[model samples]
Target: MAVAETQGIEPVDLAAGSEIDEYILDDGVFKGGMSTLRTATNSVDKKVMIKFFVQETSYQRELSSLYSLQKAESRNVISLIDYFEAEEEDEWFPQSVIVLELGTVSLQHWAHGKRPVSEVYLKSILLDILGGLESMYTAGLVHCDLKPGNIMQFTCPGREQGIWKLIDFDCACKYSAI
Candidate 1:
């Protein structure tokens, strides 16, 4: 879908079957206040989520945090698969793109749909979130936004429960910056 320009940032004109690099865009598109998210598949047909940042500052903040967490290989944190800048014709600034692992649902939505979860399941979710926080601390970064909406759940085929992961580090910053 073609997203109209917002806040002086031109959106990437993508539709179903459109190709960006080796990733094929799907029909899914989610527009946010500062970014746009689309579902896509890579060369190997692995499902992924693509985020296009409207502001360079937000893009850089998220990129920095993702890079640090990527090196730590924290399972509790969302994995950053790849990133690049997609330049548009005559556009002074290029759109910053970030490829990430696809998540089934946000923690807020999941909790709202399902009734009270089992105690064990609740414990597991808390532990997973804590693990993500610990990983961030170890990397000398802090996630300024830690809400249910920023937490995602990844469904595992063999596992009884989905894995909870922390996501959206646009507001995150280094400890030294705090």
Candidate 2:
């Protein structure tokens, strides 16, 4: 794996098999506006998704939002497993990393090239999204960047259908009552 020099901060291009601490990157990197995501596994080999924020502001925002949501413990929202800063001296590595529950698929990818769903199924998906929004609102935060790509589909062990949950929160902010 390529390491960044300490002279100046550089963007690290992570590849499959790259290990960051105990988590190992297992798939291709998915780049977003504020961060990059990768499918990884923890020390015990359980699958997880890791997010590396590009900017300090974005990292702090998402970390705060996740911490608040963690207290709320909403089933409609994605769960944060662990978080930490890279200990490596390489400036190319992202300063902040967040480990999250891996989803079966992103809503955007799940919807692509698929047939239209029943009204009940569509309503279920909408209701799940609404539930997530309600949880965020109740937690005094607003997800400013709601989109299909930010929604994840997960399937529980005993459930037949998938459950949709809100994921990204870098664009989220707190709200105060009037």
Best by lDDT: 1
CA lDDT, candidate 2, residue 31: 77
Model 2: how far residue 144 lies from native, Å: 0.1
Query: Cα deviation of 134 in candidate 2 (Å)?
Result: 1.1
TM-score, structure 2 vs. true:
0.87
Worst 10 residues of 1 by lDDT: 1-10
- Tens digit per residue, CA lDDT, model 2, 29-51: 68788888888888898989888
Q: Once model 2 is optimally superposed onto the true structure by TM-score, how far is the C-alpha of residue 90 displaced, in angstroms?
A: 5.6
| Model 2 misplaced regions, further than 4 Å | 1-12, 86-94
The RMSD of every model to the true structure, in order and in angstroms, is 3.9, 2.9
Candidate 2 backbone collisions, by pair? none
What is the Å distance of residue 84 in model 2 from its true position? Answer: 1.3
